[model samples]
Target: MGQDISQIDSNEIQKMLQKFGKLDEDNSGALSAKEFMQIPELTSNPLVERVIDIFDSDGNGEVDFTEFIRGMNSFASKGDTQYKLRFAFNIYDIGKNKL
Candidate 1:
């Protein structure tokens, strides 16, 4: 799922925004878990809840546009491998103790 953030040009961002708009069924300007899960890939993912938790940096239980962008950036391939590993670790670190 990793992609280069630097490779995300304005067109890519616009595409992302468009996709977000489509997923935001309620037009609330934020995506609820149910809304986020509407993505076909996520629909069957067992770790979907954890993924949402990781993306929702503010712990607000919803992902706004900014949070969505930040979360997507975390998966950028050009990012340090250590950072990616840490991000993956955070997804599985249920206890948050850096196990």
Candidate 2:
């Protein structure tokens, strides 16, 4: 469990971007909880607040695609324990956060 799922790869980045762009209803590069809940698949996470918690570093109510990437990069930085890395990311979205 010593992994950080935030270490998204190139493919994952593309997917994330596509999903983020679609979720940004205002055509802005950011999204809010209201905008996020619109995603059918994301309902499973139920921890959208946590995602917002991490991505919204500025304590803002929303996150821009740039902010998302920045958060992902920081959480998934090299030298992080595998479990921590995976824990921070969706590597194993079993709906549980354990390390």
Candidate 3:
């Protein structure tokens, strides 16, 4: 049976993944869109599209590793804050600007 996830810190898991970049040591600044699809946290988030937009530095329909890393970092640092605030809007709209 699968472990119960109610105790999980979803945000932390998502942030951890966001901290790591796609594996590509060739100095190539691109990651296939397929690679992005493999991320579990991304399955439910529109951030996938956002990252793709940011990573496609050349607008060539692809993302290099460096660009991918940067995109993830931005999302972790900025996007996560926004997402949590969005979720907590009814409770504390102030969370939006704290980050």
Quote the lDDT for 62 in model 2. 84
Q: 73, model 2: CA deviation in Å?
A: 8.0
RMSD (Cα, Å) of candidate 1?
Answer: 3.5
The runs of at least 3 residues in candidate 3 whose Cα sits more than 4 Å from the true structure, single-residue gaps closed, are 1-29, 77-99
Clashing pairs in 3: 29-64, 29-65, 30-63, 30-64, 30-65, 31-63
TM-score for candidate 2: 0.53
Candidates in order: C-alpha RMSD to true structure: 3.5, 7.0, 11.8
Candidate 1 local accuracy as lDDT? Answer: 0.77
Off by over 4 Å in 1: 1-8, 76-80
Among all candidates shown, the one with the greatest TM-score: 1
lDDT of 2: 0.64
Count of backbone clashes for each model?
1, 14, 6
Q: Against the unseen true structure, what C-alpha lDDT does each candidate score? A: 0.77, 0.64, 0.48
Candidate 3 per-residue lDDT, tens place, 2-65, comes to 1222333567556544443443333344456676566676777655665455446566777654
lDDT of 3: 0.48
- Write down the TM-score of every candidate: 0.81, 0.53, 0.42
Error of 3 at 31 (Å): 1.8
